[model samples]
Target: MASNKNQHFVPRCYLKPFTIKGEGAAINVYNLDRRRLITNAPVKNQCSRDYFYGQDDQLEKAIQSLEQWYGSVISEIIEPGYKLQLEHQYTLKIFWLFQYLRTEGACRRSAEMFEDMIEPTGLDSDFSMSIKEAVQTAMRAFAENMEVVSDLKVCLVRNATSVPFLVSDDPAVLTNRWQLEDKRTRGGSLGLRDAGAILLLPLSPTIFCLGYDPDVYRVPSDSGWLTLRNATDVEALNEFQVLNCRANLFVGSLDYAEGLHRFVDEFIHHRPAARHIVNFAIFEGEETAEHKKYRVVSKSDFKDAHDGIMHAQTISQIPSQWPSFLLRRNKSCAYYNGTGIGYLRQMHAAMIETARPFFKVSPYK
Candidate 1:
């Protein structure tokens, strides 16, 4: 058979749990740009593009193989009385990392960062590459990244509200409640291995898997599940989808389209201001002055949340209005109950990718 041309960055299997009746064919989507709700959108084409990873099918096949495993894992996740297990924890964390990295949203943000980094330098257009090429290059390093985050602790979050959890074109969200809220580092990026680093992915409408740095947040998960009984907490979690998604958001049913619209309308302002932040600083070359060479010193990042989570704005003002479920360590390195600080100095993955572009022209030379 001809290599599949329509490649999906968000695998259909991963979205199945959020599809209408878990049928895997249809889903509900809220498009932020359009301010529109699309009921029963075709799951197959939702987050796909033609040959997204290139004409080479190897990456596609590789993703498919792991996706097959993820499908089985979801099957178990949906089973009644499913408790998070060591084997399942590993499976979910690995899959979570894969889902976080492989999405179209993730690759596009990186590709944009690549172009933006060189654009100010007037670099030749010939040096520019497409998102697909970026995806291919990143995939080459996927195994290495998987190694870095293998140690993240995993737990399941059960949503006990009438509002089901939401998924997005970029489903896996990496946030640091500890880093962002810290007055010392409110705008700092979250490191994967850093204290209070948290990763979340909605498994089905009712439950999502959470990974964290055990040294930071002390989730009381002896039963392997943290239940979100408060609707506000569920909404707070859903807002992360809004903050992290490229354009589209997914839920299990059209029944939620109306409420989801209202929910998004209320907090859509919280979405990251830009896709990637590239900060550039120019400094003194040396005593040689004009004769010496200098570095541009640009730092580009993803999952750029300098302002913290949407509810954080409200919660910060109200103090005790939300996020009751996030438990903090008595003496952890991170801070607060649960807050997404910034990007990764450690996990080194962010969804939107920030473009700081400081580009300081002054040199001490």
Candidate 2:
């Protein structure tokens, strides 16, 4: 019989090692929950887009390294009749499947670019079809494994306009409200508006994490929590009402720092009888200097008004050449009243892969 570690299925290796100019490359494994696993050694000498385009050798090497690391981490479940065998394998399979799907997309894009450069008229439909078939096969295998595991559902709430609301028992009302709000807010898009609060309520004892685009709402207020309404007051109120159900709210924004401030205040001070709230602030990495300076000034004003206010710029480290002022107001939120700070640096590659094809970069292009 295979050892427990051997029985442990490692997801297809999707991670790649790419180096920056001065910095070396490293293989990164980011789980569904956004937790990061960095390789022991930073793979060096691999840089440039050309490096990612070559043969399958580098990809094969990465897959081997990932399998080794994964086995080392999960070698303990070797019992002959482990009850959770299906569940464990299902989880790992899905995680790796998503990673592989994303890598496949990257690979296809790289191939397309190369073909375009070489022949001017890109690869034929047959090649595209082949890539799609491979991705579909990997996705199917992962999903089939999931059938043995119980399905878990999560309720998402957005665009709440008011301070207090209740979860409606009706699903139709909830659906309609969510749709209307989505249209009004352009999909509950992230950007700063005003101050608001996000309440997290868990229906089961499951671990919860959240991610959001900060450009969707305005900057939250520094006062922690407030009950204010903007143009979409009704939609926001309705969103909060729906969210009061089995849901946890993740809040952030770039426009309204005061809005975020009020959210923290309400979350910490009110201490709703629900699951703990996890706060995160997302920043666009490609913002201009003037825009970034404006954001810093605005965030500083908000931070100054509140105690224990923490901020993080982008989920990862900022470039050293960037101004020091950009670093100010960039620490994780230290306040704890059943609330914790989660600094998520990278976007979910799996989610990105699933959504990117449907989204065209240029409406006309």
Candidate 3:
């Protein structure tokens, strides 16, 4: 019997609206013309090679070492009963036992310190030796920087294409239950918030290596107004930062792997959001090599998202008469300081607008 070609089977996969647990932020890594979401390909030397001193061969060796070690680490950490499998298109995120050391500065230090630690590892190959040294350095750093945060979690994730986000054979990464949905869904997992700092490495276009801090976000135990305020403010700030990275990728044309480091340093790492347009202009207008690499077009184009985040933070800090949900989408007020909704929506809108001119159909797609 010939099956009907026009048979309409209800698709088991469908989009769902859910919060990204802690951060609750969404970014348009979407290419509108292609009608598909764009992901940051984790290539080390794509946009710049400052980390590896501009040597492609060295970067390649480092990546190979990382790939080799990733398996052993997984076997040691993953417990039985956890059904995880290693897949090509998955994302890899590593976590530190200490929270503060998750900072970019500390991560940089870890890499440098690895050079020192490798002396004792006695690994023969340069790649193996380099990684062993880095691991040792990271361990020492973790011990030195240990805090009250939870135990370290080295996670590997199947991409958003899979539902329920669990694999059968790969090493277990996430201990918690994660739901996967369409990337374009309005309220979907555009970004994730973790308590620790992260060293996000893109192993390839599909695979990502994320190194996180030990702490995890949790709801406040106490119901004090100050506690709630602080928590909400943190969440809002995290959301803004995640969106900021997306804007940089899509609008600033920053390389997925290298652009993050530069974006963090310039915008959110140590510096507070510059509220004034002039300050933002100066930040964007500087004739730096990074600006050239990302092709910073208009100073004002970059300033919009910064201003929006600053405004959002300002609004979030004030004693809110309304609930947090209302605050996230409030768009009625015209001014940042005025009594109205939050600035995230406006910020994202501005990001999409800026990305429109640069939006191209993905060559890979």
Candidate 4:
């Protein structure tokens, strides 16, 4: 862990409600870092001039309104099993609302006036409906034109303070951690370590760090933040690549499985000679009895199965013929799809590297 004494700045995600008591209520949508203004709106006031007098005022008001509504809606709808804590739900809702509002803007009609706008001709209840329709149409056009932004890759770098440590390498650790003991027990099959490897990968121009948990066959716990870099900083890139190359393990999440898969298929499919170790933590779809059955696959089994390759970590390992392998585990794979590609590429590299040395040399000569 980085020095807690120095206190790394964690971005704050919030939905701040702004109300002058009787004057009006609005919400300010803020990202975790509070760097960008998302949207704002007035709850009771409807006059365009009374609310959004200028672009700045309009934006601020819209952000405030969005934050207010998001907090209310999430608190009302989210269920216990969804794996979204109240705070995370707030972030997700803020992201969704920001996307929604950037295209549609604020509803022209008052909240109570919504009934008057709906009609049998499929017309919406307000002018905002038209705005939404137009946004959707534009989005479809962009998607067809291959202009939609699918992922946002971020790079995070932290000076290693202390090497990673694992508590136990006993088979009982896996059985207890994943509740797999009653089903299968392999003798002396557990491996624990005080220090593990960290791999870094470049997504666009940024580098992301990856690692493994030797105790549980799971994804490495991420450092929780990312650093933006200048694309031309070759020195920084070289340093990042060196740190990544020396990493002993690779960790990944199937937070955005589709995007991750696309990146992997594109990048790794052509690199036939690269040996990589990949691990994936799959999070989507409903779990079934089959997934519950074979949960005891050990780290060694994972290492052996992937031919000792590990990189990307997902809930389930994707079967492939790309001369790559995966270490699989189950976890809440929630992540923004915008950064999935870089993560997948890193995993691909790890898997390929893990399998490279074992390929039998041809004796044709």
Candidate 5:
């Protein structure tokens, strides 16, 4: 794929070296829930995007590295056109997928081995080859061509409202693309057509991790989980957009919804010592001589929030979805979930092939 050498999109091959420990099945990295190795999750030797997201410490390290890589790119390397935002809501969505995977079964590590630090040799060559192949396939599946941001340091300013009554911005917009407010709020749309209001906020400039399910709604935890089953339900959601920012959106899963709620629940609402770090201008009307622009003060002043966000504005929720239409429909949609047995089996075979070149113990082989 075409990628700027300066830009640091997480590539699969780059992550393969981290998946395996010392050569051999004894020290292999396996999933706790499935009791199997992730290398065996791909289909017909095809590594899926979920393979990377299914990892725990490794995936976290990838994200942290990507974030840092992006920071350096925007600062010292070539800058792209799109903007990035790192609000609490945005960071959590990216983090929530791995958080769920860690819970579902990403953390079963193999026993420690001194040989882990040694380079692959002899029979271990085949095992190492499998790790490399699986990672390469998965990276190919997840690859995307993202544009370099023009203003690399530009951060999306939220709560640009002219009214003070709507000053309390809901941080839920960080995880779920939409934010549910009292329908009676003054900043955006305020319609009584439904139980409350739904505000499809502006496209977040920053990118976040994709959740398990793409087509799902984050209903109130008390409502026992809700989904827009048909066109009517989808229309209902569309019609409720008071402050319509954009129709295109990426939906979050229950993990995202609940995690966001927990974050809001424990958030320190009042930060007295917080200084005015960023100012967002809210216009009462279109920019004209008579229209008045209100200033909304924010505590966040992130200069490099554009690092890990999607390159496209709103074609899809997941960044990898931008590659091709065919890729978009594939079962491996989200990067932060797991693929089926096919991918794992393919990855496992690759490792076995790697081991065939030289003779080794059965377990290691």
Candidate 6:
């Protein structure tokens, strides 16, 4: 059973890429709340909990198997001048999906949602689920999310500037350009199948990756990879770690700690004090079962993040050089001739029904 007492939600192998020499023993950390940079923070004790996923050997085994494969793949990815491969992309995408769902921040967010649901039900009579339960439930849905992500196009980004990339406690953060532009709709959050959805994760200090809604955004690329030459783009991207990180922001090296700290200090205000913002509305003229009806929606409060205070609302707003494109709009009809798409949603059970089974490929290979 591997004595799985200390289980890492954010796999140690994953964080090693952003560590000193990819050593995994130590890394630099920027504590947002504490307003300080912690050099050489022990990687072992950073984002883990004892039995975080509960005392289940099968679950831990399944996670370790994927983590092992992911580590092997990371070696190939961080190699200098390594060409992007479909096999590698597919493998990396799965790793990102697992990382997105398997963090303490993710579990905490799920627990919040669960607790909030119970509060509304008024069945507050000791009905509860732990963060461990939330993580297990998230694991069960990994296959479903994988299918949802398959609709998006993937790309690799190579950082060309001296400003090194940074990571976070929750690395695989999801953002929707369309929704984030103007959050006027009742849609509380962005889903994998949602139009304009983008997933960003920093693989190494130099290599970055993203999966985006192909119909809405066009990332200017050569073949399958793009080089990030502008420091502004790097800064904008790094701000994501600041805005989305649960607590600690990690870097591979402290060489740019001063620069990174200055950038974070200027923009950390974009990160909200709370994880969610609740919006409520009351309607009086409803002719249904009651004269008065109440509607409330809780959304992840981020900087452009939140309903306001945006560092970069869209990718166009971020990168100055080698900019990404939001599909051109034909003023008469946006969605016509495959130009602009107002919104896209995928919910058919068959379209995303957990194909290929979970952990089908043996990690032993």
Compare the candidates by TM-score and give the number of the best one: 1
Cα lDDT tens digits, model 1, 234-272, are 887788888888899988777777798898888888766
- Alpha-carbon runs more than 4 Å astray in model 2: 1-55, 67-100, 103-128, 132-181, 184-365
The residue-level lDDT of candidate 3 at 247 comes to 27
The models' CA-based lDDT, in order, is 0.71, 0.26, 0.26, 0.25, 0.23, 0.69
Q: Count the backbone clashes (under 3 Å) in each candidate.
A: 30, 44, 13, 54, 30, 3
TM values, all candidates: 0.81, 0.19, 0.23, 0.18, 0.17, 0.79
lDDT of 3: 0.26
What value does the lDDT take at residue 169 in candidate 3? Answer: 9
The C-alpha stretches of model 4 lying farther than 4 A from their native spots are: 1-16, 21-42, 45-69, 73-101, 104-133, 138-365
| C-alpha RMSD values across all candidates | 9.7, 23.9, 21.9, 23.1, 27.9, 9.5
Which regions of candidate 1 deviate over 4 angstroms?
285-322, 333-365
Q: lDDT (0-100) at residue 76 of candidate 1?
A: 88
2 or 5, greater by TM-score:
2
Query: What is the C-alpha lDDT profile of model 2 across 1-365, one tens digit per residue?
Result: 11122111112111121111213233221111222222333332111122221234544354445555544323322222223233443334333333323333323433443333223223365443333344345445544543221222111222224232221111011111111232322222121111111112211111110111221222232221222334243223334323322221221112233443344333333322422222223343446755431223243243343222223211111111211111112222111112121111122211223322321111111
Per-residue lDDT for 272-356 in model 5, tens only? 1211112223333445675454433221311222211111111111111110100111222111112111111111223333322
Over 4 Å off, model 6: 182-187, 277-342, 345-365
lDDT per residue for candidate 4 within 233-329, as digits (tens), equals 3222222222212111111212223432333334332322222223322233446965432233334344333222223221111112210111333
Put down candidate 3 lDDT per residue, 227-321, tens digits, no spaces: 12333333222223332221222221223324333333443433224211211122333357543222323434544433211111110111112
Evaluate residue 265 in candidate 3 and report its C-alpha lDDT on the 0 to 100 scale.
40
